[model samples]
Target: MKKKTKKSFIEYGVIIAIFSGFYFTGLHTEVLGFLQRGILATGLMDPDFDKDSGHAVNTDYPEADFSMKLIDSKGENVAMEELKGKVIFINVWATWCPPCVAEMPGINKLFQDIDKDKTAFIMLSVDQDFQKAIDFNKRKGYDFEIYKSNGGIPSMFSSQSLPTTYVINSQGELVLTHMGMGDYNTNEFKEYLKELY
Candidate 1:
């Protein structure tokens, strides 16, 4: 009877371990925010920064055209068409998203380095509370061109993900679509942007 009870305990332990693993992997809430911060600290959560694969160019999904009034921090309307002739980098994210917060610094750095005249960095906030987004950016001292989506978001730039990014070329062509956080401070990514600009 003692041996049978011991076997049952081991089986239950194994089951608990399996359940815990699955739970951790499935956790997308603030419960995993600490884990994400740790990963970022260790430089393990860099953006899947790529230039070769469907990122720098997409022949099929060319001409990414969209008309949306992106409201600036000063309550000014910034039309998407104003940036048509420039290489546009649009990041769809919210202030509350852990992955979005984690990847922002790299994006800010990229924005600082890129040619402002030739490239337009549009950080579209998906936040329900637009003030919170602006406040977060100000508190973080990030100088991204953060805007609120005031109209219909185009299919080429829309995603179910909280932190999706799309790169549109100078000719208003869709070049890349990144579904999550990425390390945007890479040399390869900069070079690709240079080529695009």
Candidate 2:
């Protein structure tokens, strides 16, 4: 019985030490995000958009709030109106949020698959320290056009979540608002965006 207890204690200590190492090195976020990415593979994290429902790009919501100010990677100020596309995919995220990190790969894939002329992908970083978001983007090589918030974010995109996705159609209508991590690189999603364009 004592031998078994000693073995259990040693196992627990090793586990704790490993976690402590991850935390101190600022790798805990990535580790946790990796675990959540596994969940994303199960197709459970895919956004809820029914193409057959005819409301895939919801036409019911109010106009999109394009009042938020942003700074580009080159430290240049960008106007919201400058982002011209048939459809706009705006995602609000932070580097430290595990779920945000988990959903980014799928988003990056979606960005690559879509037609740049028809769709604009805006990865808006809300990290308190903008440098962290910039560094994280560089390390991940997601190649997304990431921006940091320069001023107050509009209320329409506001949510009680770390990652919120707002889709806007050509008419500037806020079509869909998904408030969580999502697998957006599906053929159905591609077709849905194409149709809007």
Candidate 3:
């Protein structure tokens, strides 16, 4: 009995040590994000346009704040206003965020499948060191355009979560907002976005 107990303790210690190494080396974020990708694959986290998600469909959607500023990879400035008259999909995220990393692949897939002429997809990175985001994108080989905030984020774009998403229609009204990770690359979501414009 004592030998069995000692073996169990040793096994637990090894597990703890492995986890500690992962955490200190910052590998846990990707590991956790990989685990979360499985959950995202379940399609339970996808944004629902109909349900009372943060801003309900029936309630008045405030005019989208076009004051948000962004800097593209080429160091070009962009304002929300520049994307007017088009359906917009804005995702606020960070490299250290596990859920954000998890949903990114789906977003890129959606970006590839969507009609770019009618819709604009903005991959907004909130990382303090924007270079980290740029490097991560390069490492992942995602083709979606990435941006970092150039100035203060507008009040309407603010959320209590890390991976929040906002959808604005061509009419420039805030139509939908979802807080948290989501599997956005789907026929249903694509159709819903097309319907927005």
Candidate 4:
């Protein structure tokens, strides 16, 4: 009985240590996000039918101007003001972020559905490796414009979290600001963009 108790304590200690490591290293959040995505994909969890679906983008901010200095994929400096007179969709995301990766397909679908001539899509990656951002875009076959912040990002758009997105109207006012992964391919989201134009 004493030997069995000792072995059980050791096993518990090992399990505790492993979980603590994962929690401290931020792997726990990633793991949970992965599981959530898997469950949603399996149809066991209804993503679209949820009455209080957290997957929808939250848009309740007052209209405000957006300005940013960014480097385009071609290494040319671009200003947000230059993108005025067009509906702008700005996404600050990183390739390593699981939520960012998961929402990318929806964003791409939105990009394809919109009129390119009247709207601009800027997907700025915050990856440490600039080349990795470029490579990821290429590998994913996303034709939407990719960029990196060249100057300080506005506080309104800044977040410690990855996958923040902003929608600005042609009149240079922010229409919506969203944080975290959301389904952007829905008609509701498309209607919001249409209203911006």
Best by TM-score: 2
lDDT string for model 2 (1-197, tens) is 99999999999999999999999999999999999999989998788764532235454557677777789777989877766546889999998899999999989999988889878888999888888898899999997789987777788877889799988776677767788898888888888787666
Candidate 1 weakest lDDT stretch, 10 residues: 47-56
Clashing pairs in 2: none
- Winner on lDDT between 1 and 4 is 1
lDDT score for residue 23 of model 4: 84
- Candidate 1 per-residue lDDT, tens place, 1-197, comes to 99999999999999999768756764343445445656665655454544543334556656787687789987999999888878888999987788887778788989989999999988999888899889889988998768998887877677999788888777677777888777777777888887776
- Clash count list over all predictions: 2, 0, 0, 0
Model 3: per-residue Cα lDDT over 1-197, one tens digit each: 99999999999999999999999998898999999999999888978785332323444777889888899988899887889988899999999999999999999999999889989988899999999999899999998989988988888888889899999887788888899999889888888887776
Who is ahead in lDDT, 3 or 4?
3
What's the CA RMSD for each of the models? 6.4, 2.2, 3.0, 6.7
Best by lDDT: 3
The residue-level lDDT of candidate 3 at 183 comes to: 85
lDDT of 3 at 179: 98
Q: Against the true structure, what is each candidate's TM-score?
A: 0.75, 0.92, 0.92, 0.70
Model 3: which ten-residue window has the lowest total lDDT?
50-59
Per-model CA lDDT versus the true structure: 0.78, 0.83, 0.88, 0.74
The TM-score measured for candidate 2 stands at 0.92
Q: After superposition, how far is residue 150 of candidate 4 from its true place, in Å?
A: 1.0
